[model samples]
Target: MDIELITNILFAMVRSGTPLLLVALGEVVCEKSGVLNLGQEGMMLMGAVTGFIVALTTGSLALGVLAAMLAGVLMSALFGMIALGLRANQVATGLALTIFGAGLSAFIGADFVGKPLVGFAPIAIPVLSDIPVIGPALFQQDILVYLSLVLLVLVWLFFRVTRAGLIVKAIGENPWSAVTLGLPVLRVRWLAVAFGGALAGMGGAYLSLAYTPLWAEGMTAGRGWIALSLVVFASWRIGRILLGAWLFGLASILHLVFQGMGVDMSSNLLATLPYLATIVVLVILSSKQSRIRLMAPMSLGKPFHPAG
Candidate 1:
């Protein structure tokens, strides 16, 4: 393929992958703290609607992103209150959060459906962006693209270098032991959930404010679920999350390429490739029982109680 073709594919892949990367990264942190938030879809939907509404009203992309993050945080906080504070079942509460988010976002965003905002503009670094084929493909992108990469690096360092990260990991491995060690298990878990929610919201904001720039009731589609799968595909590791996101991104963009090239195939069938790919990856990863046990958070989906 020509450089132009290659660049187009690469750019599209990165754009497609960015949101997944953001969501998966946040999930890693949440899971590392023994919180399995199946509410990613709900949090993302709330973010998309809230971000689109705020940005459309204020004409400020920054505010839109902030609103989306706030929406995510609030959704996560609700999950925390139920699952952590009240000692409810994490799985059931997470599912409830998703359902609530879907309904609430649709109700709130009813008026704004189909409206389009100007959205964020791409930024090109002066010298770097001028560097031939690699420039536009790599450097000439929106702020969120770079932010995703930065987040990956920071998260890696957070897990590898920081005491707080270790504590969170320890809690995931054994919350009961963490409590015995006098660690503030519930507090740390809440914070991790908040951080995860913020990132998921940002992922949703990118969908509305950059990817498509229009309001749709379910604009997030199912990226949130894909992101959840990505966490498992990555085996809860930071570096693998980045790779897994790009792999899924490529799968997502394949349908566009097929349609563009005048391939005669059902659009619906092509659309299933990304989701199908997700299922395939999950099956493969799950089959290796020992590996999964080694990687998965031990206390994931289990409610933790200080008084118990």
Candidate 2:
């Protein structure tokens, strides 16, 4: 059925968007707390490898996830230490982490090239999944897809209601006041970065265990970077991350459509759709609201250390 094809496509978009949503959520948290975290790409790639390796070794999905989270935490700490503790340049450190992550994943993943995880099987919700056309498309999905939605609501509530969330925003706006009020700015950032890294790692694991279920060199293929851009495109907001991920997910699925349609084109150009969309969206937003680009962080890519 043609409807089935389109239905499947929509389902794929949700699955594809899940990883981006997870990564962007973390980046949003870090950005909210006044950390740019360029090392997101690196952290993600390392998580991908670690997740893949542990799953292959232990035959346990939960253990693999834990391993991946630990790897992400370790790598993100490296990023935080360089950029935050040492007060190094955020941009430079992030770039270096990206490079290191790419190389390290490639090297470590060499032995596991052909092996892949079995990954999560999709589950259908009771009544909703039984409905006609849209039912299977929207209602039935993997655990991560539903969890992403739950995260959306949880994050929104956190920023809007919680005092800790308020502290994060306050620190981002004015560090001096947060410090004066006895807020542990550095500690907050540390927790934020660690949580963000763990989420990104989970995102990376989703790509391996759920998205592809395979290990390949550079498998993330800039999805990490795209997720990072999405945090900006969403203006460090939670709800917008859902929208942005879906948009990018659609952009990605377009490539598959082109292939299905048998359009003769270079594989390279065909694969560039999602990245192109990221750039185009950035340009459009910049042109539309140069002044009110609500997606931008006021203190992005800036380092902060309390005065002794």
Candidate 3:
């Protein structure tokens, strides 16, 4: 491909990956705290619809993004009350949250379907953006894209260099031991869940406010689920998560590349690339069961009972 084509493809890859990076980052934190939340898809949908509506009605993208994050937090709080507070089945509760969010967001967003609103504009760095092919792809992006990169670094630092990160890791590994050591296991778990929800919401907001810049039912298109898989694919490491997200993003945009090259293929089948990749990753990971067990948080998906 020519320099311009390469640049465009690279740029698209980053844009496509940003939402996954955001959601997966949050999930890494949540799972690290020993909570397995399957409600990310639902949270993302709610965030997308809520953000779109707020931005469209109020003409303020900031409020829309904030509203989206709040919507996700609310959904997560519901999950926490049942799964964490009542010690309900985490998987079942998470699935229920997804169903609920999907229905509610669709209902609320029905009126605003296809309505137009201006989305986030790309900001190019002065000197950096003028460089070669890599520069345009890396330096020219919307504010959220840059924010995602910053969040990735911060999250890595949070896990590698901070006391709170150690506490969360300890909780995930052995909540009982953490409790015995006088750690606030329940409180820390709640906070982690909330943080995951906020980021999931932000990811959804990016979809509505910047990525597609429009509202549609199920716009997340299983990106949330992909994000969940990405956490595993990255082995819960922040740096690997970035690479994995971009790979998936590249997978997602292959259809566009093919179309541009005048390649004949079914659009529907092409659209399934990302999901297909997800299944393949899961299968490969499943085969290495021992490795996964070694890397995964021991207390993951298990309800914590402090009194017991």
Candidate 4:
């Protein structure tokens, strides 16, 4: 019931949800472009370990972030190749990618285990951090938090007010029609998948270097999966993604708070809140006709023959 606890909870929601928000943002794009990058979990883990190692050794935050994004891009490209080019199953390919990424991260981080966490420092603008309770929670976060918000707004504009966005949506909606109209469906989708990889990789970097700053084996801790459901929960809208991430963040903090308060709930039950909430949101959202209209590209999970 304390004021700080609620304040801290809000702060924690923003801080914790930043990664999910980023990953969801990219996933929404990818899905809109008709590609489902299920390997987000792997992309994130690889990026996290890569970022942690690079940051620790090079003493450069930028380099660490670049390394993480690179790692994620590489992994996502692999997913794109199998799923997009060779006509493999997106769902299975994504699951395999997750396993591959997790194992690879564990192997890469083996030596880095027990090492100190390396993360970005928080930055507070003048006059912003001094605004009583609102200032500290909102403005006193690391630069990444601010960037996530910026990306959210920018992506929304991209979808709502751009020709390219329309093309991507058209491709997702009807690939054959897009092809007839002379759109580069495959190429555009490939780029979307790659961008999605980079964004999800940034999410990974947040977990290892920015959020917790520790390299744990499989440190993503189901966030990747949660991000996937978030697409449904948010109804594939960037604006709603922010709200979904915050909701998930609240669920996560609630789990911790319950534990601290000695509520005697099973650990597994507590851990299920985020996923459960996502499902509930999806159910509520599905009843709305507006949400159902945004289906993935016609060729999304379908293989692109390109010859027809």
Give the winner by TM-score: 3
The total number of steric clashes, by the backbone 3 Å criterion, in model 3 comes to 0
lDDT of 4 by residue, 1-308 (tens): 68777777778878988999989998899999877778889999999999999999999878888898899889989998899888788889999999999999999999998899657889987898878757766898998899889999999999999999999889887788889999998898898898889988899998888898889999998899899998878767778899989888878888888788788888678778767776776666554464456443445566666787
Predicted structure 1: clash tally: 0
**Whole-model lDDT per candidate:** 0.88, 0.82, 0.91, 0.85
lDDT of 1 at 275: 67
In model 3, the Cα lDDT at residue 127 comes to 99
Write the residue-wise lDDT of candidate 2 on 1-308 in tens digits.
38778788888888888899998998898888888787777788889889989998999877877888888898889888988899889889888988998899889999999884798788899999978767865779877677778877888899999998999888776677789999998898888889888988888888887778888888888888889888766767788889989888877786778687787876568667666766766776565455146645456667887874
Q: Model 1, range 1-308, lDDT digits (tens) per residue?
A: 57887678878888899999999999999999999999999999999899999999998999999999999999999999999888888889989998999999999999999786887888998999878766775688898888989999999999999999999999998999999999999999999999999999999999999989987888888889999988987779899999989888877687778787788987678767666766776666565574456487878888887666
* Candidate number of the best lDDT: 3
Model 3: per-residue Cα lDDT over 178-266, one tens digit each:
99999999999999999999999999999999999999999998889999988987777889999999988887787779887888997
TM-score, predicted candidate 2 vs. hidden true structure: 0.90
Q: What is the lDDT of candidate 3?
A: 0.91
Clashing pairs in 1: none
The TM-scores, one per candidate, come to 0.92, 0.90, 0.93, 0.92
